[model samples]
Target: MAEFYHSVTLIEEKCVGCTNCIKRCPTEAIRIRGGKAVIASERCIDCGECIRICPHHAKRARHTHLSRLSDFTYKIALPAPALYGQFNNLDDIDYVLNGLKQMGFDDVFEVSRAAELVSEATRKLMVSGKIKRPVISSACPAVVRLIRVRFPDLCDHVLPLKSPMETAAAMAKQEAAERTGLPPEQIGCFFLTPCPAKVTDIKMPLGIEKSQVDGAIAISEVFPELSQKMDHLETVETIANSGVIGVSWATSGGESAALLNEKYLAADGIENVIRVLEEIEDERIGELEFIELNACAGGCVGGVLCVENPYVAKARIQRLRKYLPVSQNHLMGGPIPELMGWEAGLEFSNALTLSADLKQAMQMMVDIDSMEEELPGLDCGACGAPTCRAFAEDVIRGGCEKTDCIFIYRKQMQKVADTISKLDGLKQFSKEEKKD
Candidate 1:
């Protein structure tokens, strides 16, 4: 079995075994055990949903730090378009780009620039009659991983394109190598990430065999110093190259709008993304040309790793795009670059399946259904599992016992007490008869 890399981690001491994180997880990957929360590695998508829901801050994301920049001879920063929304009243994008340069980065590359190119490529691909209709956006790693585990039937419908971050990292490294004559390994391209899923993508990437990105630094980790530098910069270089189409990708609907097609739908937040995926799976929206889904609420700006309020950040992004052109990046005209397309197709993960063998899987399904029928079906999360059906599957898989459910435990205890009481009554009656 292949190993999985999850950016989300549990700080054992901070967890109080609360049900909040477990209930909110789109995938039933979390459970309470030994008075603490335990996450199933195979099922986790590193979506950061738990990190956002946990009250005690027990759930945290493992990300690269600024100190790691010292490892490279030349450091390049690939700022996500979401970064543009973090600052208050951020009128110019260069303030943020220049701020990154001031923070020891040798150069800066906007992920949005790559986003524009991706948008262009997507438009061209849509015009060609090659891909399946209602192409799902492959931009959000969390959403892609969610589809891999949960929506296997819709795999082929996903866009066969690399994410803008990957595109930016590859471009940045190539540019640095040409300019400074530095080897690819020495010139590190780090993404200033808004979400933990991107960090996981850098480790266990889909589509591509390996990620070009050297590391991923959380936006919250860099926001403080970057803000300080932005305030004190004596000179702001005209480093911003992306336009409205690229910058607008910071929020939901941005990508679909960039397609210049009205026959598209955009959904944000994991719950909504799931709903849209289900609709696609059911073939309910066949008329649509594209579907853009963002796992984070409001889009990338709403990532748990980001410090700004998502709504406010979205508003700021809208204001910042007023001075920019529609789009500055365009394809040079030809076949889509092989570098911008996925090398491998998304494969279904059996992490959530009962068994791989057809007959055994069928039998397991029947068993799970029987067990589920016996459960209370409240989905109260008392048994550590997110739902009654999930608890049943866990019991059948030997991860837990049927008695783990509070309702079942109480009923078993009641039966034991009744048996004991009956034995005592029979013992007293026999003793009375003997004395008589």
Candidate 2:
């Protein structure tokens, strides 16, 4: 099993105690306390929505500094498709690839190439008899983790395939190592990431045991230098082989459009996807074959770490799409035979069943119900948890004292009133001094 790590953390000093993130959090993982925000690890999906919303720039994504590349004998850059939309008038893709090489990389590998391979794999899954009616895309690691942690029953539907980024890293490293006659560790395969989720995926992979990616640098952190190079440099003609469909994977509905499967329904942004998932759970979306959910609003291009504005980035992607080769009609034939049965089974440490026992979980639910009955349902988040129900869970888990609940405070006040009423005879003797 993959030992997943979420080292891409929110710096508490940078946070400004904003409720914007609290509202955007899909898992309701963040809570404000002591004039600061805190992230609950068990509940965080690492979707990067908080990173995108913080106004004071308190939210920052940690990535490998360019200085670290000097230690490696040969460095390879794997730019995600979202990186392509970061620059204006980037007339040629080679400008981006060559620019990375100039920025200290020995070579640049297009992540879109891996997308090509993934596209082939996706097509094969559709044709294969093993897959059920709708095979969910495993491209978004955050979505995959969300399913594993929050919606364990829906895990089986995730297509058993590595993401384009991982596939690109695997292939690029293998080929680069073979050519350079160096070990895998010597050749660092760094991804130019679009969001914190990808950073988390690289550090602590989801469905796979060990991720092929070595490290990632957020696009927003690297865009300044990359954009400068594109401004004045002459473009070189490179293999533009990553199919059109593969390039499309950077957008919200790119996967569905690439697969061109009619039964599929792709929804972008975390909250929107959750709403759809709820409908699915309620059995309202039974007719749909496949569902694609992207936590980022405009997909990877509108990710938290991109330099270009969301609308501009999306428009560039659309324009960039016209120049690429079509994936469906490509001459690459079909997926390799090995890819047909490729299965990356569930990657988890402990049993994916609820963390608490069924009895305990039910009791927690009951406690939450009682707390809601007693307290106001304003969702003020004043008690440190995002909601009153969450506060109740904290009490049940022994993380909080019951007296801290607002409703309990009110009840205690009532008890004090009753005690004072019983002491009314003693209060009459004290009133004479007050009148004088």
lDDT of each residue in 188-292, candidate 2, tens digit only? 889998888888887777666678788888897778887776565675647445767778888888887777667778888887877876776666777767778
After superposition, candidate 1 runs with Cα above 4 Å error: none
What's the CA RMSD for each of the models? Answer: 1.2, 3.5
Q: What is the Cα-based TM-score of model 1?
A: 0.98
Which residue ranges in model 2 land beyond 4 Å of their true spot?
1-4, 16-20, 234-239, 328-343, 347-355, 421-436
lDDT tens per residue, model 1, 1-436: 3598889999999999988899888889999999899999999998899998898999999999999999999999999999999988888899999999999999999999999999999998999967888899999999999999999998888899999999999888999999999889999999999999999999999999999999999999999999999999999889889999999999999999999999999999999999999999999998999999999999999998899999999999999988788898989989999889999899989889888788998988899999999888899999999899999999988899899999999999999999999999999999999999
Candidate 2 C-alpha error for residue 243, in Å: 2.6
Which 10-residue window of candidate 1 scores lowest in summed lDDT?
A: 1-10
**Candidate 2: pairs in clash:** 5-204
Worst 10-residue lDDT window for candidate 2 reads 347-356
